[model samples]
Target: MEVDYNKISRQYDDVRSADLKLISLFSEEVEMNENTRILDFGCGTGNYADKLQKVTGAKIYGVDPSDGMREKAKAKNSNVVFYKGNDKNIPFDNNFFHFIYMTDVIHHIPEIRVMFNELKRVLKSNGKICIATQSHTQIEKRFYVKYFPTTAKVDKERYPDIEKIISSGKEENLEYINSVTYCDNQLVKVGKEFVNLVERKGYSMFHLIEDSEYKQGLRRLKSEIKEKELELETAGGTLVWFKKK
Candidate 1:
């Protein structure tokens, strides 16, 4: 799936803030010291950077493949050294990071195993790696699949299961830390919110809907949200943290 970096860079904080609470909790779960070095994988616009820094006062390094995203992140946190990187390779040197964070980035990565291996390569002997990803069972996934089948196909193909993620880390010789799950669902205004999300992030690129299809899909979605009490849930990603043995 081709993500619109410019669009997502704009909505980076607003659309993704839901998981910040849980991610923050995961940050606390780690026993970080003052001098810890963190590699924030796919650190879009530095949302996690601020929280992680605030919580641990650790040096932050952000990696994103998108120039737009890296630019935004650099702008947000002047202290953060943002670099461009893709799924297959990270820009950092081997055994350089004390902690690696991959929050909500697994779905966007084209090659999962390569990224996992890269993380393992960069981590210190006892370094920790934390990853957050959307739940397999999510309302948005369900509804979006019904209207636009491509979204489902793309997501399933892109998002590896947490078990697979953990096992991949194990193959890299990292010990399993923990996987935490948290979810919150709340009724929200359907039409306005949906429009806002699309307008903000341009998820349109990911949509198979044409202008005509979008009109019909919007109507159908509105009706569904209205009838079923459409709820925006922060189906928190599985936070799998591991340490290199």
Candidate 2:
């Protein structure tokens, strides 16, 4: 199912926020300074872009296709500039950014090779691109998947494999840097909070599954929550890095 960002923009931030650990990882991988220019590719709601600018004092720019998402991001009262664009056609000039990062965004892009080529066009020589995504194993082990079996299948089909991402970057002359997997030790949501998130279809995967299946899954999830007072556990994913050749 296709997610309508404009429709969901109102409540997007309520369920999602900047993952500080992921931001820290990106900061460590890329050398950001006051003079550095950074682009948040497929930046939804500008959360990461705003946080990154404050953390590194860098010139941050955000590009996303959703007007609603861009509007929300622009309202943050930060120096980060928001633009309406996508991975296929970035509006910036050649060699414009020192670093580009996309958090959990690669799966939505249809053409990985084309994205790498466009990223290369905007990235300065040796500039880095960091992609934070779930590997197949991670997706299979998502906490929600136990209740919603279809989520794992949906995500597995939608998300590109890690090896495929690396090869696409290589084909576009983007050298592979390193890949790291992280498992957050923090509890993201618990009991009723998690149930409410699923009820509202806060996650895109919830929209993809069959309505009957979703309803059944929700019932099962609620039962588990009620019986066990379940606490939604950690979030884990892999961060793939590359550099423009």
Candidate 3:
């Protein structure tokens, strides 16, 4: 099931926030500076874009398809400009961006090839594109999957394989730079707090699951929390890098 960002835009930031460590990693990898022109592709709510601009003082632009999401992003009053656009039709000129980054967004794109081509069109020569996503192993290892098993199946179906992403980029003449996996040592919510987040459908997978399945999973989760202190593991994902040559 496709998650509706327009409907969830208001509450999207209630649970989701920019990960500082990830932003720092992105800054270092892209070598962003005041002169850098960065595009945050599929930048939902402009969380990372806003933070990155503050961290590196880069000239940043955020493009997303959802009007509501863009509205929420614009509310931030940051230097990063937000635009209503998508992979097929980016609202920018050729070779305009020095770097492009997408965070946990590739799975939402239907045409990976089209997105790569579009990225290549807007990215300057030797500019980099960074995709932050979870590998199949990482998806299976997600904390809530044990309770909501269907989420794992759904994610596996939606998210392209890591090698497939690389090959797709190569098809567009984008050179594969490298891939790295990182984990933030911070603990996710625990016990009742975690249950509250799940109940609120903090993750998109929660919205995809059937109502019956979600209820069942919630019951199981509640039972576990009652039995023992449930603490979610560290947050992590893989960063796949490609360069426009």
Local distance difference test scores for all models: 0.69, 0.88, 0.89
Tell me the tens digit of each residue's lDDT in model 2 across 81-113: 999898789999999999999997898999999
Error of 2 at 169 (Å): 0.6
lDDT per residue, candidate 3, 1-245, as tens digits? 67899988878888788878789888787788899999999999999998999888999999999999999999884688999889898999999999999998999999899999998999999999999998888888888787899999998999997998999999999999998888844576568777877878888888888999999999999998988887678547889999998
Q: Which stretches of candidate 2 lie over 4 Å from their true place?
A: 184-189, 231-235
- Residues 10-124, candidate 1: write the lDDT tens digits: 6666655434576557567766657888888888778888677766778889888888778877777687788888777787789999888877778776666677777888888
Alpha-carbon shift of residue 27 in model 3 (angstroms): 1.7
Cα-based TM-score, every candidate: 0.80, 0.94, 0.94
Q: Which residue runs of candidate 1 sit more than 4 Å off their true CA positions?
A: 10-14, 139-150, 184-191, 201-205, 208-213, 222-234
Quote the positional error of residue 144 for candidate 2 in Å. Answer: 1.2
Model 3 stretches with alpha carbons more than 4 Å out: 184-189
TM-score, cand. 2: 0.94
- How many clashes in each structure? 1, 0, 0
